[model samples]
Target: MLCAYTKLGMMVDARHLFDSMGERNSMSWTTMVAGYANIGDMKAAKEFYDLMNENNAVAWVSMIAGYGKCGEVGTARRVFDEVVVPDASSWAAMESCYAQKDMRQKLLSYIQANEENVDGTDATVWGFFIRCL
Candidate 1:
């Protein structure tokens, strides 16, 4: 229901339903974050993201994409930096954001610097960079 409301752009109802819930799982938290982010409500998304006990890739990617959509690439990078262990989706989201914003040099520099930190053998991670190039 919360997901449905959020998907329909009915955040007010979604929030009401979310707030009334006694227990929230990661999916519930992520749904709110994604919903808020999808609507360009980064403040709300960030608030929910901060409240999440265990940050998942979906929520992290959502925040990055949301900031990118708002033209806050720097902030998106900050969110990306916060990921402890970014998955392929997170890398793809950040790389796509950088590409869309024409930050090629930054993207190359970022990829170069971060590649050493990422699993050098993870093809999915490497694939995003390859596609970016």
Candidate 2:
């Protein structure tokens, strides 16, 4: 219901329902974060994200992607850097941000600096750069 409300852009209703819930799980929290971020409400998204008991890759990537959508590339990078162990999706999100913003040099520099950490199976991230460049 909360996700449905948020998906429909009924944040007010979503919030009302969310507030009334007795026990919230990660899905609930992530829903709100993704909801607010979808609406360009970073402050609210961050508030919800920060309130989460444990941060997950979904939440982290959402923040990075949210900030990226808002043209806050620096903030996105900061969020990406905060990830303890970023997965391919996380790397793709950051790379897409830099690519979309036409920051090719930064993208190259980032790839070079992070290459050592990327395992062989995460070829999608490298493939993304190949297409982007």
Candidate 3:
């Protein structure tokens, strides 16, 4: 229900449903974060993200993408830095964020660093590098 409202851009209704959920799991929390992000409410998304007891990859990616969409690349970078184990989706989101800002040098550095640390880069990450280059 909440996800449906969120996807439909009915943020207020989605938020109400989110608030009504008695036992909000990680998916519920992530949906709220994504909802706020989808509505261009990065601050609200970040606030909800901070309040969560457990932050999953989807939540983190959504928050980071929200920050980027709001033109707060530094804040997104800080959030990325704090991620303990960033999955391909998280890295792809961050890469897209940087690419959107035309920060090619930073994107290259990030890809290089991730390649050195991780086994391989995801297709989206490679796409970011290719598009930026």
Candidate 4:
């Protein structure tokens, strides 16, 4: 329901429903964070992200994307650095952030590093890098 509201751009209603839920899961938190991001509220998203005890890939990606959406490349990079094991989405978000900031060299370095860390290269990562280039 909250996700539905968020998708509909009714962030206030989503927050109301979110607050009413007695049991909250990671998805719920992610939804709210996504909502904040959609509405260009990076501070609220970051705050909500901090409150979460267990952060999944989605949560991390949301924070990174939120920061990127707000033109805070430094914050996005910091979040990217904090990721333990960045999945494709996380890496893509970081790449996109760098691209948006016109830091092509840095984005290329990240792609190379990520490729070295993983046994096999991800096509999505390559695609993201190519798009940036």
Clash totals, every prediction: 0, 0, 0, 0
Give Cα-based local distance difference scores for all models: 0.89, 0.86, 0.82, 0.82
Best by lDDT: 1
Query: Model 4 over residues 21-68: C-alpha lDDT tens digits?
Result: 999988999898888877878888888888987878887888888788
Model 2 residue 76 CA deviation in Å: 0.6
Ranked candidates (lDDT, high to low): 1, 2, 4, 3
Residue pairs clashing, model 4: none
List candidate 2 segments past 4 Å from native.
Answer: none
Per-candidate RMSD, Å:
1.5, 1.4, 2.0, 1.9
TM-score, each model?
Answer: 0.91, 0.92, 0.86, 0.87
Candidate 3's C-alpha lDDT? 0.82
Across 1-133, the per-residue lDDT of candidate 1 in tens digits comes to 9999989979999999999999999999999999999999999999999999999899999999999999899999999999998877888788878878988568768878877678878887667667657
Error of 2 at 15 (Å): 0.9
Off-target runs (Cα >4 Å) in candidate 1 are: none
**In model 4, how large is the Cα lDDT of residue 22?**
99
Q: What digit string (tens of lDDT, one per residue) describes model 2 on residues 1-133?
A: 9999989879999999999999999999999998888787999999999999998898888888888889899999999998998888888888877877988678767777787776756777668667657
Candidate 3 lDDT by residue in tens digits, 16-126: 888888888888888989989877898788888989998888888888898888878888988887788777787777877887898878978876876765545357666
